[model samples]
Target chain A: AQTVTQSQPEMSVQEAETVTLSCTYDTSESDYYLFWYKQPPSRQMILVIRQEAYKQQNATENRFSVNFQKAAKSFSLKISDSQLGDAAMYFCAYRKQYGNKLVFGAGTILRVKS
Target chain B: EAGVAQSPRYKIIEKRQSVAFWCNPISGHATLYWYQQILGQGPKLLIQFQNNGVVDDSQLPKDRFSAERLKGVDSTLKIQPAKLEDSAVYLCASSLDSGRLTDTQYFGPGTRLTVL
Candidate 1:
């Protein structure tokens, strides 16, 4: 069984600051995918960023970037220039390279302070 | 394109009661999923359907849960004799395909269920 772990239960950052959320997974499969999802107060789950295990280059999408260390099974999300609107519950998820089922970690609630 | 849709934004029932939730996937999507997310936890896949056929249901608690997708379009998940531990938010998601390489699941608002 594969499991994702988000160590930070609650994170707070001031507007314009940078914050990084840590996530680690246990998987023996070489081919896999890592993802970060943001769930706003509306409870709508939105994709943040994605990383393929075979890719060496870390993936970045606008303000979101992932530091994926494949060998260590560590995938972390870094939010830069954070804005107030970025407040949400961020969840780190994992999927087998060939399976669509996503295994998610305990979410981290992010609060953007003014 | 519109995202996945789920019905009955919130539901409350007593222990041992039964409750059913409905989900409508995105148009043209061939894969649909049902997930259970309890407070302070990530969503857990309950069942998955690929064009109305069961793909994988290894994690589903079969004794108390059953889900069906009719004609590979819409789906319904029912829980009979609900228990307090069953209280959780039910999320419905759909992907363009069942194959992981091209799968990007879009999730719904989810139906929050509370059992007393």
Candidate 2:
């Protein structure tokens, strides 16, 4: 079974600063997909960024980026120029290349301080 | 375009009571998923559907929980004699195509259930 682990249960970042959320996974399959999702107080899960295991170039979406190290099985999300809106419960998810099932990590609560 | 829709944003019931949740996926989406999220934890996939057919229900407690997507669009999940452990937020999501590697799943505002 594939499992995702998010080491940081809570993270604090100041506005206009940068913060990184740590994530690691254990998988025997080499081809898979990783994703970072943000859930605010409203309880809507929003996709922040995505990364394909086969791609070495990390995925970047605006102020959000992921440092995906396939060999080490580490996928961390970096939020730059952190804004108040970035405060949310962030989840790290994994899916096989040919599978629809998504396994998610416990989650990390991000707090943006002014 | 409108995102996924879920009815009854909040629900409360006793341990032995029955409750049901409704979900309407995004227009034209072929894949729909139901997830259960306990407080302070990540969402766990309960069931998945591909156009009215069940793709996966291994994690769903069939003895007490039931879900169906009859018309391939709208879905309903029911729990008979719900348990206090079942208290959680139920989330519905949809994807354009489950076969695509990059298909992104869009989620709806979850329905929070409180079972006492």
Candidate 3:
């Protein structure tokens, strides 16, 4: 069984500032994938970013980036130039390389202040 | 591309009642997934399917929950004698690969279920 954990229950960041959310997971599989999903008040789950376990270089999408530490089983999301649109509940997800099930963390509510 | 589609955006039912939700995955996607998202929590995988065959249903509360994907294009989830804790949003997602390595999954808006 795979489990994802997000330590931060809620996070606040000023507009144009930066913020990072922490995530950790327990997985016995050597190959897997990680993802970050954002859900706003509209209640739609949207993909934010993804990281492959085999890749040493972190993944970056425009203003979003991730620090993935495979050995430590740690993956974190970083938002630069944070904007109001970033305000939402963020989730850390894990999936085995050979299975289709995705294990998700509880989620961290992010508030972007102006 | 059209994202996954789910019907009955909202549903309210009393305890012990039965309800069903529908989902249409992205065209050509072989893998379909159903998830339960409780308020203030992340989505939990309830089931997974490859084409018309079920891949996994370990976390599904089978005592009252049932799901089917007849032709693999669209699927339906049902709950019988709903429990109060079943109050949550049911989400549907689709991926290009049936295997777990797919990093991208398109999700639907989800059907919010309320059991009173």
Candidate 4:
């Protein structure tokens, strides 16, 4: 079975600064997808960014970007110019290229300090 | 486009009580998913549906939980004789097409259930 691991339980970042959340996965399949989701107090899971395993170029969405290293099976999310709204529970998820199911990590709580 | 919709934003029940959750996926979406999220943990997929047919329910606790997506749009998840361990947030999500690799899943405001 495929498993995702998020090492950081909590992360603190100052407004206007940058923070990176680490994620690693174990998978035997060569083709897959990775995603980062943010869940605020409202309990809505919002998509932050996503990366395809076959793509060499990392995926970037506005202030959010992922450093995807396929060989090492590490996918890290970087949040630049962190704002107060960025404070949430961030989760890393994995999905097979041909599968609809997503396996998520434990999650890391991000706190943005003023 | 409008996102997924879930009813009864919050639900409370005692042990051995029955409860049900309702979900309406995004318009035209072909894939719907149900997830259970315990406090301080990531969401776990409970069941998945492609239209009105079940795609996966392997992780679902069939002994007590049941879910169905009839008419290929609206879905309902029922829990009979709920247990304290079932206290968690239930999230519903939908994707444009399960067969497309680039399709993103949109989530609804999850229903928080408290089994006292």
By DockQ, the best candidate is 1
Going through the candidates in order, their DockQ values are 0.93, 0.89, 0.77, 0.89
The model with the greatest TM-score is 2
DockQ of 4: 0.89
Give lDDT tens digits, candidate 1, residues B36-70.
99999999999989999999999899999999998
Candidate RMSDs in Å, in order, are 0.8, 0.6, 1.2, 0.7
TM-score of chain B of each: 0.97, 0.98, 0.95, 0.98
What are the runs in model 1 whose C-alpha is more than 4 Å off? none
Candidates 2 and 4 compared by DockQ, better number: 2
lDDT for each residue of candidate 3 in B1-116, tens digit (9 for 90 to 100): 78889999999999999999999998999999999999877899899998998889988999999999998789999999899999999999999876445547889999999999
Q: Model 4, residue B83: displacement in angstroms?
A: 0.8
lDDT of each: 0.95, 0.96, 0.92, 0.96
**Which pairs clash inside model 2?**
none
Clash counts per candidate, in order, are: 0, 0, 1, 0
i-RMS, each model, one decimal:
0.7, 0.7, 1.5, 0.7
| lDDT of each residue in A22-112, candidate 2, tens digit only | 9999999989999999999999999999899999999999999999999999999999999999999999999999968899999999999
lDDT of 1 by residue, A23-52 (tens): 999998999989999999999899999999
Candidate 3's C-alpha runs over 4 A off are none
